[model samples]
Target: MLRSSVHDHTVSTVPTREPRYEKKGLKAHRQLAEVQALQEAGQLDEALKKARSFVAKNKKEPAGWRNLGRVLIDTRQWAEAKRALDRANALAPDNPSTLINLSLASYHLDQFEAARSFGQQATAIEPENPLALNNLGMALIKLDDFDNAALVLRRALSVRPDLAPALSNYGAALNRLGQFSEALDVLMAALKLNKSDPYTFVNIGNSLRFLGRDSNAIDMYNQALALDPGMKEGSVNICNVYNKNNLFDASFTISSELIEREPKYVKAHSVMADSLIGLGRIDDAKAAAESVIAIEPASITAQALLVSLAARADDYDAADYLRAARRFSDLHDIYRPDVLANPADDAAKLRIGFIGGDFRRHPVGYFLKQLFTEYDRERFAFFIYHNAVEYDDLSDFFVENSAAFRNINNKLDRKVAQEIADDRLHILIDLAGYTKYTRLSALVHKPAPVQMTWLGYYASTGVSEVDYILADPYVVPDDCEAEFSEAVLRFPDSYLCFSEPDCDVPVRPAPVSENGMVTFGSFNNLNKVTDNVLALWARVLKATPGSRLMLKTMLLNRQDHRERITQRFAAEGIDLDRLILEGPSPREALLDAYNKVDIALDPFPYGGGTTSAEALWMGVPVLTKRGDRFLARMGGSIVSNVGLGDWVAEDDDDYVAKAAAFATDAAGLIDLKRGLRQRVLASPLFDGRNFARKFETLMTSAWDAYRARNDGEGR
Candidate 1:
């Protein structure tokens, strides 16, 4: 085998040693070419290794270390790059390129101070270098030296107009400084230069969202997601669009989906709670709100939702809700002082702030419509803080006369507080007590120093912060003073003084149906129709065998709910066919439905307010049984005030007797109906100016008392 392998020639290989100068020259040329080739190919890792090898072999070559640092930057080995670049600078102390590389590496590692020093050195060496200027600007931005960042970025852009990164970074600086419109233009230009930049699009959206172009912001989010679907921020932003538009169900669906992926996401749960509340799923809303509180104990959303839930349930455990509310109030605090001198001060000219959600066609509005119309603008300034979304004709009058009217519909409590403080209000009244959309948090924040909860809510807020709750002798009996958060302030005849609008309908002289079955009507919310109320109503129907009970409410608008109500009445030994369940009707139709009812049956525990008034206006007397609480006596109060004391029953037994007697006394009933409208029209209950004057007197008294209590404190 050895003889056959003669061609292998293992005997003849001699190691060649060349002259030192020639070998060194050849090696130097080869190393330089390798470094240049790797750098040109953008193989920074391989290039760094090659350059480092060359530096090790030839320690005197500054170019080798400089190239190595540049390669380190490409690999983002910023610290190592800084060291190598520093070595190159030391070896050749005046090289602008070496100084620039050192600055770049420092900037990449977020060492803005060191980066700025090296950048200054580079610019000092070659003051007009566009790359160096751009690098300096970016470092300034990273350091949050936004003013300086703007100056340097503009300089760089002036030197090199096509620099996309510098333009985009400059736009962000403008955005940080609140020049959103200009920033939008610059960011848009950056996008035009480089269309696929996700950050630029996100920044553009951020500016748009800030400007309240929420739909445009949503479109921008969609565009960003289209470019990169994994943008979680964009997804959250899209959900916010649903929130802003009041498409709460859509928002909830998106939030629920997000929760599946991130179960403890606090913002998602918060949005879910809001959406659920909008959908009227209060129990589910409570659960979602609890989840938010569990995740973030100090979250404002959680605290506010819990407050709302307690208010809605009519169970104010005040401790937590009150404390949080006080904290918020302290932050947004405002106080009122008499601006005019004592002699010049006109009690008639004090500023009045009205806070509520129902300036629309609601119970609170019905009572105040005439008062606001006759508020005597020459004597007082008025401000309204409306919390609800819906509005009607009466709302326009409030808007027109009020010195300032703020629709604080979607604003947070803090923002609302700030606005109130800005207004420098004198007297603040809470027209909405515990009703839905009543921002108790804003009241807690103490936007105004003198605050009173009045009118709309019957029960005490159970928060000691309130100064008073407006009532009358009938609604606030002297014995029940302990039930109030504020001192009980009573009007002369009634707490609710109706302001009669020109909506007059002529009284129908004849009976609704002498031939038709004797019909009883109740127009109230389903929530007010408690079990006991239903039982009493059932007794009224049973007492008159042929009489039909017309149970009417908004809830009955839904077929399923209507069926449920019918079934419930049937279970109470009422003939289902005889129970005429009617849905919500328009105002005119509601009045028309009155003619169909021979008598009105009021709800127990929570009697009808506006409905009772409406029935009286239509000349239909209501029979109401007095209960212990204010809510239970609204009907009795209205009936008594309208000069129909006989119609105001004293108890369950009296209610049955009164209703049957009214049914049997057709001639007396006819006389009562024919003359009842005139009686109400003349009564103090419908006198708007009289009520407003009384209300003003009460407010002046409250202010006087408030000032007297704190006179020595120099408030």
Candidate 2:
């Protein structure tokens, strides 16, 4: 979950005392006291009337204006409060009381910089004022200055250890900084002091969510909502958690209700889009995302969603995806920093940094395991900048193998980029493009002289700072070069190298022989199986009689998703009896499940990557239709690398024809199945050592080019 909104504490007011005014200002002091009393009594209208009368009589006195601002704040009139506060500040420059009120008013007006300035002035004047420090910290938090916010909040806490508001804000800063455990501790302390503080509960929920305790996080959010039923952040956060966990129905329900209540809620619309994407409702997802864009034109999340959706749309090709990606890039234009200097030495050990948020049992992690384990560390120093809170054994492997491993989950994009720039990496590779928790924003800072995007994401990042994209000749053909924003650096054979599965599950014989029928399956995410892919699969099932298509993915765990898939397939003239839909399973079970299939049907426009490799590893030949873009061509790359290019089809007709013909040849099918695993294992696709050598060579080549360019420019 992203950082939850911080609810500022009630504005602190100073005692109204006229030390400067003598006997002549006695009446003014009395009037100020009366206004303060009325404001304290919550009679804001009466207080405002009295304050206006006092201000009108003593137009030059800062006390009257300050009292007026305080009453305006009590009435939630932020703009007028700011005006009055500004008047008071102009009258009594550097007055701690007036400055504090100005800070609060500015913060409410969304003038965070002004708020910070006022807070700084107040803190400078009264060094140990808890209210000044607390307000300063809150403003810093709004500005994504968590490091400074944490420091200021720490000072506030030191001044008054039981300052619950300071404690809550400090916990929020800790959460953003990626110190979930410490954040939880601080927030829990705050909760003890003020159980009814809804924002504290939300902050605690964020910490729990970051710690991978989704259920506990949900409970915390519920606690927050229970305290304040009108807390939109708490409701939106719960929807976010539900979406993350693939509870699309729940997320959709909550987001829908939120939209009904408040149609302009951008976060709710964004989560609704996420839920729609998970449910394979791409068109609806696009609409939801468009709604977000309409509401917030510069929404990075919505633009990124459109990029992914366009890539998956059959009607939308690479050009459309690029357009969407570039729009997403536009949102980060403000974040772009000056390019860091190139490394001076040409022959030194090239320090290569890999930045992403998926070094924990994800497909990206699996793909990188072999490379990390087998790469020539002597020639290239590896640096891992992990940007996620969750880490498992795979993460440990990365840490153990890398020269330096930093968990940058808590740092802001600019700080992460600065850290990377400070590291002076020769080449930095972005493993995530626009995926969740992506650190792609760091790449915009141009932290390294040579930056490229490789695995994890299929399409071009459209980030101008990204110099190249790792590809193979098959996945990125010459004709498609124009589609990518980055220069394509093609490998000789396959761009990816699969790690041999650790499990020793023996490949079973073709299921067609035992069952007297062909069992075609696809274990990739349902979202990848677009409407066109489904219709094509339906045709394949129709062409091959007595065939069953087994579709298993995480989304199938939801009954609504299963029904949706069944309905879509039924509309394509496929019967329910011939379809087999199953939910996710353990890795071992998933691999073993492939034994029941004779052939695997790969989805198009966004074909399987790890799933395709896994299918081949399980002796199931993946029948893939070639596509125009990298996302659609991955299956062809994998299958061709395995010397089974015949399984790759040119179009829908060819796909159905291949499936039908392959099923008819029962003997050939069994023999192919028996030898498929060995074929893949012996091919370049599984050659980790070979892939590492080529990878290192490419890195060296790219670095050499970078140096040559810089030298030509006299850098």
Candidate 3:
């Protein structure tokens, strides 16, 4: 193969020429025109034959070789087209068309860098070449250089506003940058240019999904698939919609077909994992995620799925999976606030900051409530930066106690970071990981100097700048330190210290003396009740014959959802008559329902958190299996911290046995329930002041280390 001119930086131009009037030149030009018309007519084979004949007769004409390359490109023979384009460019070093053909050939072969180089040369030679600019932008998109991709496409649009390719790809760049609304507008403009473009429809679907218009997005995806039945992205997105709508059966069927057709399709596998999780196939979900990891070892989506699956499976290796997910993806950077703070400030109290959207009756809020109530105002100033629009009554507590409270609901991450920095916070902590409603990308903008991740997540953040994860020895052992992106900073006792609501329910002195039926209850979210959980619960109910299990959760609020859950359990040999499901009741009424439950049966894998705490607070003993991840070990953590280790089971068998034991030993169970509330109240978990002191100590130590290193810089 001939090599093109080695002018890497400079653009190649088409040499200016007038038609030569000689007979041979006239005949050659006529043959080239005939071949070009054939190529445009989609008769690539005929075009190639005619081009080869012209090349044989007119061996010195570069146009003949360029025409052959264009034909090869049409046939998707990229490697052969590259060779022909190379020879064409070598023969006529300044041919813009030859350079452009080479760029297209490289693009088809997935050689984005080479394609970009040739595209740059083509655009430089013909500054108004919209095709060349569009090519450059597409290459940049593949390379994840969205900023420059946007710049190049904008230039392309400037030259040709109706450039469909430019608009479509520019919209994709916008999507990558998280500008979904703008991406939708750009994609709509592209659709107007060519209504038949299936790619634009897919892009529009992506933007709409991100903007929370999932139903409309599903319609767009369906339309794209209808337009081009073989579109893989649309197929995967359609499956995603099914999972989002809680239609796991449909999602699993579609994803199974997708896996068979494209075994290495990572996104499809991730979707399959979610569908499997919903179907109550924990092992299958784990396998699907493992398949994704096999294909792309560093895939963030795969690792996240694996973490959730492992947690839900109640697997002993769940914590390791969480660590692996963290290692595989850099979730977010921990800001080092001390670096950005003024030195020689030892005399003043340290300013601590909490950044997250979950300060409103959420799990993060439940854990953080104690922090605010117990924090020593004289020694430290608290700064709470809320990023969410909604706030519950609990937010009032954070506001009343915090030294500086800022509602940054509508502000972007950069602006939020500036506000935190302006407060001169010594330690900035991230409560939200990569979970939903989390603004993690804001930390990527480097808002603070010392940012760390704590509660509200169980996986690695995949962020490089994030400093550490506040944990306990039980949560992150010393040997497992290497698995985390951030350093594992072990705290004393428990990582999370629970705060008992001052308005605790009055404990009934007498437990129900009735014994004919055993009441089983769980107050966790409906999403946590996987198929495996229902199956296990069914087994327990079967073992304890004549006993009815009462399942209380908010999802049971809808009669249809209750029936669906009931039907699923019935299929596992649990009769609908044996299962009593209840909707969400008022707080006090819900607490009173604990009297009806002899023993609280916790869900496996992704176990209970606030629900478990509330159950114990209601003087109900919860039977739970110890798990590796936070979601799995909620009961274990709360029970152990509250001095109820006997209630914490080590495995599934143990959990079942404990439940049965509680049923057999009615008197003992009643006694345990009566003293449960008192035990929890007496434990250190309820001592908010002590927990706050420990949290403060950890933050100050980290800040002091940052300051000492900076202080010794001149020495």
Highest lDDT scorer:
2
Q: Work out the TM-score per prediction.
A: 0.60, 0.94, 0.72
Model 2 residue 63 CA deviation in Å: 2.2
Off by over 4 Å in 2: 1-24, 56-59, 331-337, 342-347, 712-715
The weakest ten consecutive residues by lDDT in model 1 span 1-10
Inter-residue clash pairs, candidate 2 = 177-410, 178-410
User: Candidate 1: deviation at residue 701, Å?
Assistant: 1.5
In Å, residue 470's CA in model 2 sits off its true spot by 0.8
Q: Residue 274 in candidate 1 has what lDDT?
A: 62
lDDT of 2 by residue, 135-211 (tens): 89988888878899999999999999898888999998888777889989998998898887788888888888978
Tell me the deviation in Å of residue 161 in model 3.
2.2
How well does model 2 score by local distance difference test?
A: 0.84
RMSD of 1: 15.9
The local distance difference test score of each candidate is: 0.69, 0.84, 0.72
